[model samples]
Target: MTLVLFNKPFGVLSQFTDRGSPTTRATLSDHIDLPGVYPAGRLDRDSEGLLLLTDDGRLQAQIADPRFKLAKTYLVQVEGVPDDAALARLRAGVTLNDGPTRPAEVERIADPALWPRDPPIRVRAHIPDCWLSLTIREGRNRQVRRMTAAVGHPTLRLVRWRIGDWTLADLPPGQHRIIG
Candidate 1:
């Protein structure tokens, strides 16, 4: 059995191959060389951090399947300092275009010490931004970004700090490590 934790960098595709792109894009293939291993879940091209990979199908399903409800934690930087009401709404679950989300474990967090993102997130001089530590069991496309947007604070940067029992701890961007 093989379990790999990858620190996916910004602008990097979650898949090993960038099959349909009109131009070349960085992918897991650029970083990971282990044969027969596939990403357990996807991290958006614009997002960064912990992306699990596995050669075992059952293990991959356990990590990636929403039915398993594995908690995925993100350190999010948002455009505005969310008010108590906004935080409450996020904790209680907000209605998105697709549907209402399950309640998430969320709190305003101090800005984490992280490697700088390539090209960096935009900074607005007039509008102050803040960080949040949020954990969700469901994997929806851009769910964290959408959920924060629903509360009027758009996400500027998102990093998956942990997924299930694995973490991005000590893993720098564009690096991968394999464990049994």
Candidate 2:
């Protein structure tokens, strides 16, 4: 089975092809040339970082299926410093419009040393921003963003730092390497 680890840049689609969009956007094909490999899970167009691709259907299922509960970790930058209550809510799991989320491992973290985003996130001089290392066992659409928003600190930037054992270490934006 072929497995590719890609550091997806912001504004890029998780899929290989961009279809029917009014304007052209970067897709996986722009970084990956390996045929038959597909994304195991999606990273939003606005989010950046580690994304896994594999040729094996079984492997894809293992990585993406919430039933398996493979932990996915993210480095999130929120609009304000999350208080003890907000952090506790995240660790205990908060309810989203879709439904309740699985409890996540959450903690405030110093700003991570990472590649500069192409179009940087917005800056607010009046309000403070902070980062968090959040790990969740379930994949819900925009779950991290929604959770933070629910806690009153809207997400400013989101980066998938690790998925199970795989991480983005040493991989630059818009680059991919076959791991297996």
* Candidate 2 residue lDDT tens string, 73-93: 999999989999999998889
* Per-residue lDDT over 1-180 for candidate 1, one digit per residue giving the tens place of the 0 to 100 score: 999999999999999888987999998899989999999989999999999999999999999999999999999999989999999999999999999999999999998999999988998899999999999999999999999999999999999999988899999999988887
Candidate 1 runs further than 4 Å off: none
Question: Which segments of model 2 are wrong by more than 4 Å?
Answer: none
Report how far off residue 20 is in candidate 1 (Å): 1.7
Cα TM-score of candidate 2: 0.99
Candidate 1 lDDT for residue 87: 93
Estimate every model's Cα lDDT from 0 to 1: 0.94, 0.95
